[model samples]
Target: MIYKVLASILLLLVIIGGWSWTEYQSARNTLAVPGEQVSIDIKKGDSFDNITHKLIAQNVNIKPFWFKVVAMQEKATTKIKIGEYVLKGGMTAPELLAVLVSGKQKQYSITFPEGWAFKEILQEIAKNSYIEHTLTDSTIDFSALMAKLKVEKNHPEGLFFPDTYFFEKNTTDIAILKRAYDKMQVVLNEEWGKKEANLPLKSPYEALILASIVEKETGAKVERPLIAGVFTRRLEIGMLLQTDPTVIYGMGDNYQGNITLKDLRTPTTYNTYTIKGLPPTPIALPGRDAIVATLHPAAGDSLYFVARGDGSGTHVFSASLKDHNAAVNTHQRKAN
Candidate 1:
């Protein structure tokens, strides 16, 4: 009787071992998505069961029990990250498990062009589906926000760098803003260190102000340093920067595209013509090229510039008001 019991126990053990081996083979060899790719969004706080259900919901034929066992065996249950993932055709259960364990998520991008206003930047953030929108009028107290971000300035304008930023899903607007802000800080500091001798700018902030002016002056990449030259020369000579862009910015929403004599004569902190110095803050976000151009401006005697008006975005540089007036008249005739 004891021999019979021992034989029965040995048979049961062999049966169980065979079943486990077959299950392992099935998991390693079977493709969850046979011929087509599948996309799944594993949200934050999703459990292993939830992820399995999501895969099944996408018509992937994964065996949930075996998948859970594989995940546990590989210690990938807690390693899975949240984001959109793609499973390609003929991806086996083990391959899918490897992907989830790797924690690679889908990336999205947002771009901020030079001279974008703070409002426009916020609008772009608001419209993006991948970013987490945490900013609202209710949460924004300018002073508090600045304090929270540890920015020394009182305003948020021109603080964030203009660049294309990529991030995973659920990234907050503040997080993106912080990245841009830190980039600006590093770039501005590096450029400030390389600034030409006898610069009129007293600080990096002043250089940023001039750079923003240069950014608004022209879109031609080659002309940035030339425009910076004009402003730097004017500042050094104590000449009023009669640039129309500053006046337009000063006019705010009241500026209806045309800068009348009234707008130019209006007194505002941003009006370079009236202020006789750099604006109290940056008027718009400037790119790294503009910042670099301002710090290392082109060497020239030109202090005035007018639109070339031949439908070319280039400007005609002038050493005196007489030449500038002539260019203006020529531009006016072309406009007529």
Candidate 2:
């Protein structure tokens, strides 16, 4: 009787092992495609069962039962990352499992251009599928996220380096912003280490502030240093920066092409015409070129510059207040 019982148990074990092996083989065949591409979107907070159902409903040619079994065996059912995946049409179960486990999903490139403010940046992020556009207002409440990240700042302006970032679709806007900020930290630290000694900047943060000003002063690719020099000189002499862009930024959405005397005299922290120093924070995102220009301004005592109004995106730098006024009159007042 004991022998009989032992034989029965051995037979059951063999049958169970064979069934498991067959199930795995079936899964591999179900997903095996050669060259076709299957685009799949995995949303955030999706469970294994839901993801299986989604795939089945999409006619992905993946067997739900076997896929679930394989996922469970590989401990990947709960681990499929949320993102857009470009699965090759004829890939096997193992291949799909490997891709999901390794988190090799489709990536979309999102670019943040230079001179964009936080609101613009957020808008750009919202326009991309990679981010959740929750804040529809002009001013985003960055305090909550900043506090969560333990960052001491209320806004991350110059802190986010402008670059083309690759992200999986359905990513949160905050996550993308954090990535930009992290990249900025790396770039800022590297550049700060190479800065010239005795710069008027008290810290890396100050350099970024000056860079932001330089970014707004000129759009000319090669004239960033001269613009930086203008601001740095004014800062050294305790002259009000007197930048019109700050005024424009202060006016926000209400700013038309016209700048009134009242606008310049507005009692705002960003009104460089009234403020003797840098604003409380950066006005826009400064590119690496602007950042470099801030650390190495052109050698000059000229304290003024004016737009040429030629629509060539260039400015004329002047040394004396009289020269600046003459250019302004000739280019701006007389022409307009």
Candidate 1 lDDT, tens digit per residue, 58-157? 8887788888887887888898887787778889887887777777766789999999988889889989988998788677877777787888888998
The residue pairs in collision within model 2 are 32-90, 33-89, 33-90, 33-91, 34-90, 36-89
Relative to the unseen true structure, what is the C-alpha lDDT of residue 75 in candidate 1, on a scale of 0 to 100? Answer: 85
Stretches of candidate 1 off by over 4 Å are: 1-23, 33-37, 88-90
- Model 1: pairs clashing at backbone N, Cα or C within 3 Å: none
Model 2 per-residue lDDT tens digits across residues 7-56:
99999999999997887788876555435776667888888777777666
TM-score of each: 0.90, 0.77
lDDT of 2 at 228: 88
